[model samples]
Target chain A: MILRTLRLHRFKWLLLTGYLPLSLLAAALVGDPVRWEDVHWLDVFGEGGGALMVLTWSLLILGSRPAGTVSNLLFIGLSLILVTLWQDNLDEFWTIPDAQLWDTWLENIPMPVGMAVLTLGLVRWYEEQRVLMAQLSQRERFMREHRSIDPVTRLASADYLNQQLAIELRRARRECSPVSLMMLDLDGFDLINRRFGAHEGDRLLQAVTELLLLNLRDGDLLCRYAADRFAIMLPQTSEAMADLIASELTSAIRHFAYRSSKEGERVTVTASAGVALALSASPEELMQRANRALSEAKQTGSGCHAMAG
Target chain B: MQWRDDSLEATWRSPDTPHLPAHHHPALLIELAHARGIPEHRLLRHTGLFPEDMRRGEAMLSDRQYRRLIGNILEYDTGGELALVWGRQSLPGHYGPPSTQIHNAPNLAEALNCLHHWRHQLSPLLTPLWWHNRQWCYLLWTTAGAGRRGPFLVPAAMAAVYGLARHRLARSLDWHFLFAAPRPTSPQPYEVNLGPTVRFGAGVDMVVLPVEDLYEPWPGRSQTAFTAAAHEAERVPALNGAGPTLPEVVYQSLAAHPETPAGLDDTAGALGLSPSSLKRHLRDYDSRFQALYDEVRLHHSLYLHQVMGLSMEGIAERLSHGDRANFRRSFRRWTGLSPAQYQRLLPE
Candidate 1:
């Protein structure tokens, strides 16, 4: 960990260490010697302590982060202040000649300048934090909703659908693999709920979900896109394969005899579907394209429609 | 200290329902706002909470409302390491009664036990599950459906434990943290705060500790104070069915086997129950064990293969498959591509 930090802030550390030799040379040239009787242990502790604290803070910031603009600013500022503190603390043990002005310049110059740079670094850090929080929020939302289930159909929810689609699209882009989405909508589902009770409609939805799941390929993720609309995410599937699945789904739904528990009556439900190959990053956009095709298919009264976008 | 004294009277709430005031420490909220140089009124806006509520018990808001406040804070502020900052500032006193009991335990084991027993009172989010052999102790943490707050919650929980341990035992204890999530781009804050031992993309969010660490006594351990604290802990509201639910048990069982799945009979035997009894328990939870098993398998495979970067054979061996060929076939059937092909699809 220390090694990583050293590497991250090598320039700052080098600059700080470079002063050690200069200080030693200046002390040697001064020729004034310190006596045991003249030593102020209290001043040594106070000045030395301040230098050590600054060093610790610098190490902490450097160790935790990689080289970035904010980190660079912080390290530079901290090092500047650290040098000033260290040189002032050294005056207690060694004497510099009264004629030499370098020590006084070192003691006074870096204080306000260091503080100004540090203030700038802190301001940048605050801005950087806002971006991180947005990213954090997105990450947490992704984790929570990644495996969300639709209570009605016992299928994956729209959130999960979008997540999977994003993954599939990235993979598709990488491997040049074809992934497809099938959007299926039950025809006039509200009419069924109005005619029968909502409970009966719910049972029909469940039965339809079961039928869809049974018909789906092992790799397919069937998701509830919205009320009465289902989405199937098919990975490693060709355009031809997607068309076959869409037609199969349309026929299967048409053949589905959903019985209402109240009247024990058989209700035949027909569905229109639109299939699209994965082409974009935005799951919403993909869904919209599929919906448009479905709406067009509905106008023609066709059971299924396939489009490449 | 005065801010704490003033805010301490605000009621500690159960986050189980959306109705209660989600935060236990309003002072922390004020401090977070203050750090950002935001006004207290602006911070409390839409939360139906006032900073004055910390003094006089008037500001009460639902979980939904509190979440909105968090959302607002997040929206305006420049990106900062909010979770680490929050964790660093988390004092045990902010957690109220249950925290006192957890803090005063004679040793780590008793402290952990106290924490486990009173967890529902502190927060409904984290439930620490303990598993140990003779040498090492494993405390696996599972979430109680705390969705979007998970990013903050995980680190915050770690910070709390870290602070408590440091205060009580000094540098006497040795432990490392493991998280199931993939490593983030900026791991510096986590590395700095959690030290070098933090591992991401691991099996579970767990704390690995030597068995000896549990026996080390806490400074200022008192039996009298602990007993009183525990007594007060009991007054916190608990769910009707206090024991582990069947789904939770099944999830644990599945989580235990990332490479090899345990059969129904085997899992039942492991639980010291018959297969029928296991089935009955699962039925009471309104879910089939098979469905739960599939869910766990799907989630585990995604983590191990995608995040942990394990080979298909390695995953198969972990899942306990005898034949690599059989595993390959099953993998293909599940994903519509061979393991190697699927791997090629992922970025390096």
Candidate 2:
């Protein structure tokens, strides 16, 4: 999978690989090999290792990200750092004539230029993350831990929801505010999977996740609780408020009109929700209550929402 | 004499039984993982099987390979719903003769009997043994040779049974499921697949079907098809050993004579085996005599305490415990909870 992602950075990799031979050719033409005793093994190891480490970091950044201005800037910045470090390491093995002021300039000029470019890349990367963080506010809150993100929908997993719920419950206790948890499940999701295969089912889920995320409020958190169930944590929301939001979510899913990626066939889906208001209850208890309510709503019919007493 | 010995081996399904169809149970796991976009090769990685072999329907997997395949799928299972989904989709399966028998059974009772009779072919991983009281029929789900994957496989097995019955009966059966494992992180899978009457952290894994529903007539009852399928199923050879597994034999001995607090030697003697040989057999099944003994003892103790409403002292005396404190300590050791605390988790 990482290799698949790295395939997108072929040009960057080609440039990096091409640099190695060119630099070797330049050093061989302009300088002579130093005596074995004159070579400082320690300096060679440090500079060579530093350059290799920078190369790995550059490769990782390129592999994980798509081709864009930010990625290009990062690639260019890291490439310069790698080049300067490589030339410095090259100095340990070859002795250029003292008349070679250009070699000194080659090492010093790119070092400061690379540092500036890296700083610019970092600023852009930070800006990119800020925009993504806004889009991800409903999926996570307070902090982001990559381990907790579900691979399918890219929403937070149930365990992450519980962690945030505990923190929210603690805050609610301090502020004396209401907190609610709503569990929404796609109706007959397994049937859809059985009919169209799991690939299409996964695509439908990804589509539904986007719809739910779009409908959710900024502070409210949405989590993939289980197979077809999603849990939304509502802070400062009462049962009545949660019920309204639950209906809205159910309707949004009901009217989603998701088209299967394989056949482009229209697949209509509906969701049922179980909403429970927190009242001095632990996270587990609150989740169980919401689950029970959701089951009841599902038992009644699709596109229905129920509130726990 | 050789024929008799072979028949005895055929009476029980030992862990090494390679009777499970490659394209059936293991294929279902492969399909479920594949549906979530996990490649077939990844699911079959290190299991030494291929999609072509499974598709050809010529390959058979032993309990060991089945365990490995399940482990691989679970390694990629981020949502933890694969087992439940696999279970829900497993019923009325494509396992040749046994599946044919199930789909044509006259009633729920007949369908269950067919499953029990052909368990080696139908459910090689987990075995379903059932009995009835006045009000309810208790279907005990025992791990045939799942070893550490027992808890995961049991739910799937139960879900498969529940789904098969529901499909044939054309109505949802009220199955009160008791799982030996603790409640999971989420209950939606159990609720959606098995229904709401699920109790976790029980002493044993079982499904409590009300007797009234057991004899309910199935809609697709074909007498001719049922008999023909049964005949075909009878012709199907045993995968490995066909009777109760090594653990099942030990469980029966321990459960039957719960009053003795039978040590390994005594239980081994009852099964007509020497202690060391019995230990070796249990080892082959990935089990220990002590674990099976503890499980059976726990099963009885819970049954006595919960159903018979026996107190700590009475239950201890019944299990041949010399003192109440010893029983309390042992119960705590077995369940990691004192009797009172454990009972608190039970429903009133």
Candidate 3:
């Protein structure tokens, strides 16, 4: 893409290449060139490093962007900045006479002017990217269409959860941030099924799920992990923070007076949660750890557990 | 505390953005500013807008850029009053397919109907939320501009609608305009654009109209011309993000019925597609059938309780919920608000 965009500015590259040689020629003719013994290698390395970076940026931009007004401005600005660096480096190799004032004309003048053009291009590019992001968001936002919805809970299924977990993990890794997972298992759900009739138990589970969702922050993902279990992915969250959120969820569900669907009766629902933090862990590994903590909570009859792996 | 529309953030929209929506005529809008005494070049300058950029006659502009231009004009004595004049002079003529669609409709109601249906064809960013009953029609307008740009557009749109009613349909019905923003110290702008009946600090920005007068026919009506114009409007590409697919149409239909509207087969038949084919078409559109149905149900739940101010039980019943409490929980999940509370906080 960068190459294709740079191809449009063929004349600019040609002129840039031509200008470099002409400057070198001007330096070679202006005064006596430095002898091999006197040439300071350190100055060449210092100035050359900065010039290389700038030149690389110019090439990268040209290659990545299409032929447009902004790209042209960027190229011109970068080219000017590159020439300033080149002249500074050139002064190290060759001596220029003070009478000619060629060094000032070549070096001092173009730096600010070039910088101004680059700034102008950057502003326009920002505008372009904003428009593109809005246009792209329409298509991108729906990529995960939530096709695998669980019939009973009316939330996305375990498979969907895994897919979203993977997506979130990739994003988190790119951003170098932690992602936390919350797992909730209804305490003594089987007993509710046995006591309140399976129908009432289903309603209780649905109500509990809704309660968890109500407490969830925006951009949190909720999914049905099992028959009476739920999983939620909290992006950009640490283990301690995720544990705090799990406690909030446990309390919210604990306090919720879920009513029976078949008959109008208040059914109390309490949940045990396991919060797991991701650090060099795959989605499956993260889920396994959370489920492990969840089982431990169920064993110990504790409200929640935080697993910081 | 007063309800505010400032919750409508302008952050996502680019500041000093170009590409104004197609509804506003650059030549006409710029010239209108000129007629109001601000120089044309001054209007175009610094906004990165040019007369030539709009020469193709299909230029789109973001609200930010348009706001800057309007802000510049507002610097003069006629500053904030530019909206009324812009609406008065620029309606019907400067607007494109929407204006043409208006004449094709048999009456004001159908004209508004055509406008709503083909709204994206008019402009991508300009969306009008319409509510009506037997007695009155209320319209709330939104442009893609950030929320700060909203106040300027509110008066501009209401005045333009007034111009449309008076000039095109030749019907002068009783109308009241409301602004969600606080009332200005000088109320002359509101008076001039909307006359004496304007209300500000009302917690909703809308134009209210007598429902009966909307049925009034245009000054000159022809069935043949109306049909031709409506047909043409239908063919225009909707720039509003992939346009409304069949599933979206079904979702919208379900909202109005207020009951279990229809199954997939029946909805498919209505849209002239086979049930299996409808499923495939939905897949093509990247939508699932049941999800669309649920989405519409949730959307209408919010719509009924918030926009229509329906009771909790009423909205609950409309969605076919077995328990209103269950519906309330789901509403909380969706928006963190119980139905009644959401209704109170909902922007008018």
Candidate 4:
């Protein structure tokens, strides 16, 4: 059994290693001469590298691409070119054995035929590579954007919010526009953890995140600030508008049925939020003021919203 | 400390289902049986194991039964090697072919790779191949039925094979480390049997042989035949219709003290059931309880004696003996040899 397993692995390697060498030798035996019957020797020299250039280019192509149909096609093309060069090189060495001109026939037809087939393969390969690269680029872009989003709630994280805040703050300053920050924290989150369990607590947080996102305006940005806390950045909005949005968020959380594991037990979940105007302060300072008001609201009771002083 | 407290409570409140014995871990039982030369049927009889019950492969014997069996074996077997040898042989499939393949490998590394690749075919439930300290190689094989035996049997088997293979090669096993992560049991057996020096539960079941052993061509096929003879040296007939059922007095005594020398005379004297009459009743169930008791006690004793490190005196006490001397005499009479001699023959 062990020997068979070893042989199987060895067989795979042997297939991979032998294919290229055998292809190259076969091509060499049937390739056409580099110096064509009608073309001048100086034309080949003027090309600077001739058949060697093709060899170098094929090596480069093999090195750059992963193993696939494109590589296989390129390898076959290169092998044919190499074989043609080898046949042309042989003409400089041995005389023809028969008057039948078998060497001329071997040197003339198969090399060009192989090159034509290889060219067709290369065209298909190029088209396939183009589609593959497009898919790869789209995947890379999605991954890059996904890094900024929260995994659990699919909302933006604090880092993303801060970047958006900086941009909105700059635009507000330039255009004499206004922006407001609304920070909300869940009430009795620790109590919920103690009562139900961490898994349920996580589920409740996800529910609240969805509620807040639904309550916000299309232009507003919602982000998770800390455990059981979230911030919404509303652009071109006044403190009064932010407070109204905060109230809507509070009401939604209050009405949400956070089901407990215990039968017939449903907890009325609520949030305390605070709104701060970015009228005469930087985005960071505005965020700090909103956080202070949120803390104050949380201390007072559930469903309370306070404005930054 | 808090976790331990929780576990203790959980263990106490846990259901006493036949599948989850309070004391005997099935993995440990199989391990001990395999380690000791005692047959599986004998081990089963002592533990009150019904082959049909174990069909699902999760049936467990009570802790009391496990402890009694281990204690009995230790008291009866002094050399402490039989359990280990039994463990090696009970491993599913023939070890000879694999051992041969590994022995003929160019190097220890290649030999281990071979064992790793092919071990699954031998026992599907057995865990994948694992290494310990770069010297020892370990593979786990699930028994015919799952959860019917403990992992202690694996280490015993490994230790035995390591010792025997080294001896066969005429070199020290040269293993620097050994480890296994078998299912947990209350009283650990590997610690006592393999050695105080070797580590257990580091990761997986493993045997630590010298790296050079891979290059050594396995001793000729003749060595395989010799090993087979040594392995099968203690073959005991499966006790069929040879033991009492639970309702009978002899059955009660045997269950109460599995390690008690359950001779026909002794059981007959206690129950007022003449030896002949008792045998007749046992025949109805297709078993004699006394023979069942001996088989069970033999298996239990080997495990306790070799794996659990229980002293002979302690085992004798558990077996309900009046004294240690009597237990020794009885043990000798049952097996045709002294407990110490039997233990010495076990794999180290």
Candidate with the greatest TM-score versus the true structure: 2
lDDT of 2 by residue, B1-348 (tens): 000111122235556666677887678778777866678887888877878888999887776677788888777644446787788777667778777788888877787777777666666655566655457666765563457778778888788778777666655466788776777766655765677688778656778787777787778578898899877766767433356666765666565666665898876776688999889987877778877777667766766665576887899898755588888888876777788876665444
A169-272: candidate 2 lDDT, tens digit per residue: 98888888879999888877766866776667778888888898889889999988777788999999976788789989888888787888777888889899
The better-scoring model by TM-score among 1 and 4 is 1
Best by lDDT: 2
Q: Give the range where candidate 3 chain A is weakest over 10 consecutive residues by summed lDDT.
A: A135-144
Model 3 bad stretches (over 4 Å): A1-309, B1-24, B52-79, B94-96, B121-124, B142-146, B233-348
Q: After superposition, how far is residue A86 of candidate 4 from its true place, in Å?
A: 21
Worst 10 residues of 2 chain A by lDDT: A190-199
Judge candidate 2 at residue A243 and give its lDDT: 79
Q: Score the docking of each candidate (DockQ).
A: 0.01, 0.34, 0.01, 0.00
Candidate 3 Cα deviation (angstroms), residue B252: 9.6
Highest DockQ against the true fold, candidate: 2
Q: Which portions of model 2 show Cα errors greater than 4 Å?
A: A170-177, A193-200, A236-241, A256-268, A279-281, B1-17, B36-39, B74-80, B104-108, B164-179, B182-201, B208-225, B235-278, B296-348
Span of ten consecutive residues with least summed lDDT in model 4 chain B: B1-10
* TM-score of model number 3, chain B: 0.61
* Pick by lDDT: 1 or 2, better one: 2
Give residue B263's error in model 1 in angstroms: 14
- Give model 3 RMSD, 1 decimal: 25.3
The Cα error of candidate 2 at residue A198, in Å, is 4.4
